[model samples]
Target: MTRTLVVIGHGMTGHRLVDTVRDLDPAGHWRVVVLAEERDPAYDRVRLSAYLEGHSRTELSLVEPDFLTDPRVDLYTARPAVHVDRKTRTVRTADGDEIGYDALVLATGSRPFVPPVPGRELRNCFVQRTLDDVDALRAAVRGGQPAVVIGGGLLGIEAAHGLRLLGMQPHIVEFAPHLMPTQLDADAARVLQRGATALGLRLHCGTAVTSVDAGPDDAVRSVTLANGTVLDTDLVVFAAGIRPRDDLAVTPDLERGERGGFLVDAYCRTADEHIWAVGECAAVLGRCHGLIAPGYRMAESVARQLTDHPAEPFDGTDTSTTLKLLGVHVATFGTMPVRDSQAVEVTFAEGTTRYAKVFLQTSTGTLLGGILAGKTGSRTELTPHVGRRPPADLEQLLLPD
Candidate 1:
């Protein structure tokens, strides 16, 4: 007898879970059922900004043509799981459909966090999350119009770049003193700032948006900063941060992390033995990692367990990031030391274009973490040697060959 596996949410991580399970149990030991909230199937959200560059929805899709046609897999799109009946081991969808499961997994993912500011719900305001969001933004925007993007994080920068691509003049407003504060130090952020300015992006760092003002037509017109500076614009985009989509887990009385997300163990198992969670919704070991890499690992771990295969516990995640922002290359890896006393800091800079910094243990030569801006040719070589000591030629690791 084959057991039924019900997966809630069909985002990138959820799709990976289903694919992995099918690979492990080709004999159909566990039949898979996926409940997707979106009308369209899973797409490459990591490259979501590419949609702004004229990439069609089909181009962004992560699903293979024949993958969903598998006999053992049942996919229900635009069906969001509304309730989890823990006692009955069942899930209730918003469309009034109920499905029973021998094992259940929640991959509800996350939502963009919009700040509580007046006029935020105005017509031209948007958040970058799904294909529909980018579509809406594309339709609303007019070339050469001004746009204000709140938050200077990765998502915010990406949204700003997309706005630039749409021929809109984007002004980035960040509460932090520098750009990419989570990933880069003040000096590195300066280098990044230079690149963004060169791309015609206006940045307002160390300020918060006090309110989003609207025009007489109730459409977003301008934003007032905490520092009394007001930026007139036709669009307002919120990319501040993300919060887990764990509302459905509330009725089940599932434990949640302190920051948010359904609390789960290293195995991605919740309090209920039969139910598991992966992706942004699952707070494995009291921490919720927003990156796709950790989410994919969690999905694979859950898939292996359901297949009765040996799997390693998810102890932690690699928070390393490497990407291009506004035509500038940036990379950050390993643990960044906060104080100078903790680790030895080595930095190299070249004419406001290239900057590289590495932190090494004070007692040992072990690499703690590093930041690369402009030129990131060494990122691939240096990332792997993060916890370990690098070769004797340390200069070779810092510069491009």
Candidate 2:
């Protein structure tokens, strides 16, 4: 007899779980049912900013037409799961429908963190997370206007770039002392700042928005900073951070992480033996990884467990990141040493256009971690060598040929 596997929230990781399960169990050992809150199917959220570049929705879609046509699979779009009855092993949807399952998976993902400030609920304030959010922003904004984006992290920078592409003057406001503070040091951020300013973006670092003031029409008129500076703008976009969607775990029996997200073991299994969680919603060993790669690994692990195959426990994940922001190349991988006592450090810089740094173990020549700013030609070659020894020409690894 085939068991019923119910998955909630069909985002990127959720889709991956369903896809992986079907591939491993071609014999139809599990009947899959997916409940997606979004009207559209899973899409490439990592490239969501491309939509601002006039890319159509279909271009971002990750699903093939025939992928969901399997007789054993059932997909319900625009349906959100509201409650989980672990006792009966059933999930209740907002539409008054309850679905029974032999096993359950939560891939609810995350939501953009909007800081609690005065007038945040006013019109024209947006959070860039989904296709609908982008569409709403594009429709509400006008060209040649000034817009303020809260946060200077990766998502905030991407939001500012998208707004600039729409012909709006974008200003970034971050509480950190420098841009990409989580990934880059102050010096590397200066290089990034130079590149961003060259593109006409305004930066306001080390400051927080105190309030978002509204105009006479109740639309956003201006935002006041904690430092007493006021930025006059009609729009405000918040990309400060993300918080996992773990509200469905209402019962105290369902443990949650200290930061947020459903608490699960290394195998992605929750406290309940029959229920598991993957993606941003699953806090494996008290930590939740916001990146897509870790979520994919979690999905694969859960798929293996359900298939009764030998599976390895998820000990940890590579937080390394490589990406282009505002036409500037940047990458950071492995463990970044904070003090001289930790590891031997090597550094190089070429004016304000290029900067590189690497940390190596003192005892062994093994690469610890590194950061690249302005140009990342060596990122592809150096990333794989993290936690291991690199080529003899360590100097050449920091510079482009």
Candidate 3:
């Protein structure tokens, strides 16, 4: 009898797993079923900003039909796994079909977290998550009106840039003292925020939105701030954060994180050895790996271990990230939250508002983490800086001094 490998999410991780399984077992020894909750097939969600900025669905798809041609791969879209039975190793769908599986993988992924502010039921207030979200946002702001984006991290800033690309006045409201509080240091955050403001993105840091006000029926009219200031805008989209899909975890008696994510071991195995987990929905070593690269690493590890390849263990790294904002370059990586023993250094730009700063461990002179702006010519060299300990002056290595 052929073993059934059921993957519960058709995001990037599930797509990667299917491809990996095919390469491992080309023959018809295992059946693959992907339970995708969203419509429009599997897409690259990391590029959703690009999609919102005018890129079509075809440009944002990572797995085209050619990749899904394997007869073994079965796709079920818009169908959620309603229940799971670890004792009998089966997952029941919304339609009451209990799909039996030998090895189960829940990659149910995450959902956008929306706060309980007033007027949340307004038609123009949205949480950016699915292609449906981008579509709704585009239609809402079709008049090229002013837009307000809540939050200031990666998603918030990127969405702000996307709005500016769509020819709307982008306004960012952040509760934190600095933009990208998780990614950039205080000084770096100010620099990037300045870059954003120069691009006509009004910044409202160090403040929280008290409530959203809707006019007439259920349409967003203006946003009220904690400071009692009301900013008039037709649209309000929340890029706040992500919440993992853990409704089915209870069905299998699986352990979950405090913030609600499936718990998994290094091999991506859950409490039940036969069932596994990966991606942002699964917490490994207490971390919800949000970046696509780490998710791929987890998927590759599980695939190799299952095929008897016996690959070495995966060491989780500080997921550093860089991105372009309305043509401005911004990035941050490792040891960003400075400690007492870390050495902080900086370099300003020659004529433009570009600069680079690095933080290092005082004792070992090892890179702790840092950020770069204006010029990203040294971005690719970060892999070598973090991957291995190269014996050289860090500044010289970063810019040839």
Candidate 4:
């Protein structure tokens, strides 16, 4: 008899697990059932902001047209798995249906965190996550008034640029001292700030929003800052961050991380041997990985183990990131801050056109990590050399060719 595998949450990592499993297990050892809360199938949530640039829904979808037609795999959209009963090895759906499973995988992903502020629920206040959220924001943007984005991280900058493209004056309000604070150092962030400003975005760094005030129509009229400054706005977009979805953690025997994700072993196995967790929902080694690359790696690892193939325990993922935001190139790899005592650093800036920094082991000259802002031409090649020594001299490596 074939085993039943129930997978919850049809996000990118979830879909990747299913695809990987199907490709490896062509013998049909396990039948798969996927439960997704969203009506649409898995799509590229990383490129979600591209929707504002005229990318269609189908273009962003990660689902293949013939994926659901496989007899071994069954996908249920808009049907969320509400309860997990380890006693019977079954999962209860929101529609009052319970499906028995031999193995369970939770890939519930994460939800946008809206800060606790007054009038946040008022009209025109939105969080950019799913296609539905972006579509609603697209329709609501009339493009004359100024829009305030509550975060200055990657998503916040993307939201600001999207709104700017819609003809609204975009203002980025960041609680941190600089933009992309987690990814780039102070000097690199400064370069990114100039690029953002040149792209027509207004920056408000080291500021916190005290409260959101609404008008008589229950729509956002203005936002007040902690420093006693008020700014008028048309809409408020909250891109603060995300919280892992661990709703099923209430079930007995299910372990959860302190920071709100399912606690799993290096093998991606939960407390119960029959259950496993992967992607943003899974916390490995006490921390949850929020990047897509790490999530993909986790999915592949779990798929290999389930298919009875040789697999290595997931140690940790490289937090290196490279992306273009608002027509500005930004890349950071290895460690963001050189915290070691014996660390050597090099910096070079070509007027207003570029700024680059590289960290090396002081004694051995091994490349540890670095940041490149403004005209990151060799980011692709340099990223792979993150933990290794550069091929050439440090001076030649930092030069903009």
Clashes of each: 0, 0, 0, 0
Q: Residues 144-165, candidate 4, lDDT per residue (tens digit)?
A: 7899999999899999998888
TM-score of each: 0.96, 0.95, 0.92, 0.95
lDDT of 3 by residue, 1-401 (tens): 67898988888888887778878977768898878778777788888888988899888887867666878788888887878888888888888888999888888888887878888778888777889989988887754688889999888988888888888987899988988877666766766877887888998988998888888877888999888778999889898878787777445478987667887877777778888888888888666876787788888888777666776555565567777765667876664634655564555443445666776666666666667766544656764675335346655544443
Candidate with the larger lDDT of 1 and 3: 1
TM-score of model 2 vs. true structure: 0.95
The candidate, 1 or 3, that scores higher on TM-score is 1
Residue 121 lDDT in candidate 4: 95
Residue 134 alpha-carbon offset, candidate 4, angstroms: 1.3
Stretches off by above 4 angstroms in model 3 are: 333-352, 387-393, 396-401
How many backbone clashes can be found in candidate 2?
0
Reference-based lDDT, residue 94, model 2: 86
Q: Between prediction 3 and prediction 4, which has the larger lDDT?
A: 4
For model 3, give the 10-residue run with minimal summed lDDT: 344-353
Model 3 clash tally, residue pairs: 0
Instruction: Give the alpha carbon lDDT tens digit for every residue of 348-394 in model 1.
Output: 88777888889898888899878888864557788788788866776
Best by TM-score: 1
